[model samples]
Target: MNNDERIHLLAKELIPLYDDLAADTRLVVEEHARTCKICNEELRRFNATFAPLAAKEEVEPNAEIKPFKKLQAFKALMVGLLFLARFLLIGLLVAAFDPAAPRLLGGNIIMFYFPLAAASLSILYFFYRKLWFWVLVLFDVFILFFLDEVIYYLLL
Candidate 1:
């Protein structure tokens, strides 16, 4: 094809990339085919079409948005530990419900304390560094002792 035909070809090819280029682009293609028989007419027929497309307001990037980061394994470990403690509490409560064990030992309140202490300790450990973690462990031990006493009383 000639030079004009080539410009038309470029416009036709690039038309699909833009919406306005569809019908208007054909007009451009036809105009190129008619005028400038010598070819190399760089008058830029789609200059306005390209300008509006370029100037179109973009969906601005979320200024309030924060970048995503993966949660640390330690965090997940702590969560799992807490959940385990919860399950333990639930199991103990189930055991407590059995009437065969006597009201004192098998009561829900005493059983719940075991799991509560465990869960509390797990949470404390997860949030604290190595130095402060011993505090949670101590509390956990204290809860166990308290529960033991409750059981002992109930047995008597």
Candidate 2:
């Protein structure tokens, strides 16, 4: 077959792969499209729709939440904004929480680790250079674990 015919055939076969696609799959689809015009045109449309999405700038919620359903969103937003604006002041926050808070009043420090882990992962994702992230994580873990062991020893 001529180049246009070959591309058309390939595109007809491969266009469905566009839904969940990647570079390797695209390359394979393109290989067949190179010899067919019809397939090439379809590939162009598929790439237009799928490529930008695969580039992944951000993740939107799958569906919109209703107003009442968004109460948690507002609570989360306030907590996130405050936590971000004054991250360094978190040590002070520990002391400032209501004394009647069961988790805090009980001296159960495990409750604190969840926020710490989230903060740690946020820093890693923002600073996505893998080596520096791993080094910082290891260093933080070492320090925290050592501090915990020391505290445990002292308490014993």
Candidate 3:
């Protein structure tokens, strides 16, 4: 087709054509528009049509709807507790490996205290909405049920 017909055809394909056009093709089209009246008119029309969409009004955030500082603080506290839970887990593991731990801390210490502490930590994790929280809970459950077996195998 002629120059005017070609420009009209390209104008019909507006947004998708502009978006998907190669950089070299876009530069060529821009150069062509500067010299060609039909192409220049098409370019102006395209810009004018989308100008309102491009010129977005700045939206002021609602003053009443502030960030949840309390929730963030709660999450931070939960993270701190998760670290404390890991610390307790490490201590339990160390004590389980120690041959004299039972005699020193009393026979029920390994059987009771660590598991109880782990369960409490897991309960705390229930409030936290993170993958690590679930992982920690599962790990605590494993330790609660099978830690004695692990100690037996290790001590043997």
Candidate 4:
């Protein structure tokens, strides 16, 4: 096609004329329009035609939405509770196996595992999302098995 025909076709096919364009395609089109006056004019006209429609659809919110803040606070509370439960469960398991250990050392040991488990769970929670929830559970089981082995060796 001739340059004018090609420019017209490109203008019609441009994403800004219709829908969202891929970033790479948008860059290619924008670069071409920058160098070509006819294409630039065509794109300008396309944008001008649609700009009014886009502007008319804009709606200003009358009131700030507050429900999302409440939901976020609830999520934070649940995560805190989950960490606390994990620490307590780990402490109870360790205490059950080594009840004769001095309270000072026992408390220190439990504190160590609390941070370790919290770190592990935090990494799994952020990175894995819902797909690896069971992985955390399996990790707890593995920790329990390792503790059992340690207790058995120490007692023997």
Candidate 5:
């Protein structure tokens, strides 16, 4: 073959390394590289360029996983606390529903209602973390106390 024809054949063989050639084209290229010194040299140069990238050290993330595990543990604890608070609120409400419950220091059942309302508000505040809910709870407590005082004055 002439020099131009030989160069053309070498270029065709190198096409598989640079681009995704057909399977038959890749087989033909590999066959030519096995016999042609020029094509073999080109293939070696191309493979050498990628050799460093393929031989890099892989790093293990053993130390970084500890913090992630700690975060998961804290998340589980918060969920447990939230469920506990909900159950306590439900138990308190059920106890208050009993007709035989004793009176507090003032002999007024209204006195106990304030602490129940406060506990419910605190639970809501802890779970939601919203300033608006806290503000509304405070406003409700104020209104409740004001209404209770007015009714007491009317009864007396």
Candidate 6:
């Protein structure tokens, strides 16, 4: 092909190469564009479309807004509480309707704790790496293990 035809074919890829192609490939395209007026103009036209956005400075959030809001902590805690309650809620529902549903350890009503604890730990999927996540998990484990005694003492 003639030099002009080669430049025309390569110019079509200038925009994509400039935006996202691998560094080595982009460098090769850029070298060709540097020598070809057509490719140079094509790349410049593509960049000009984004220049306005790139030139604009980002505004900071309002000073009144806290960056690390405690609302997240509250939400995580509330979800953790819900996780702990799910066991008792499901167990009570089953026992109330069936009246003959089996209980943990022959008579204890804490049978649901095992599966619910797994669900409770899964809360980390939402609150991963948060301080409240580990705290709630440990608390859930403690309650999971001692829920029978906890109920007995509460009744007394």
C-alpha RMSD values across all candidates:
12.0, 14.0, 10.3, 11.4, 12.5, 7.9
> Residue 152: error of model 2 in Å?
44
Better of 5 and 6 by TM-score: 6
lDDT of 3 by residue, 4-101 (tens): 66755564454336645788767767766776777778777877886676566445656466669998798778677767766675576556565655
**What shift in Å separates residue 93 of candidate 2 from its native position after superposition?**
38
Off by over 4 Å in 4: 1-67, 98-128, 131-135, 151-156
Model 4, global lDDT: 0.64
Taking all chains together, the TM-score of candidate 2 against the true structure is 0.29
Please tell me which predicted candidate would have the highest TM-score against the true structure. Answer: 6
lDDT tens digits, residues 1-156, model 1?
Answer: 887557866855664454445687657755764565422233344544565666675556775755334545666676577658755765575455444554454345555666676556666666655654685566556545564455556545
Worst 10 residues of 2 by lDDT: 101-110
Per-candidate Cα lDDT values, in order, are 0.57, 0.58, 0.63, 0.64, 0.56, 0.62
> lDDT: which candidate is best?
4
Could you give candidate 2's per-residue lDDT for residues 14-97 as a string of tens digits? 697766658887777778777667677887888798779877855576867456657657655754664464444344444454
Q: Give the C-alpha lDDT of model 1.
A: 0.57
Q: Of 1 and 2, which scores higher on lDDT?
A: 2
* Inter-residue clash pairs, candidate 6: none
Q: What TM-score against the true fold does each predicted structure earn?
A: 0.27, 0.29, 0.37, 0.34, 0.29, 0.41
Name the better of 3 and 5 by lDDT: 3
Tell me how far the alpha carbon of residue 19 in candidate 1 is from the true structure, in angstroms, after superposition: 48
> Per-residue lDDT of 39-147 in model 6, one digit per residue for the tens?
8888788788866765574456564655566877876686767765865664563344322332342233355555665665675656565775687678666665665
Ranking according to lDDT, highest score first: 4, 3, 6, 2, 1, 5
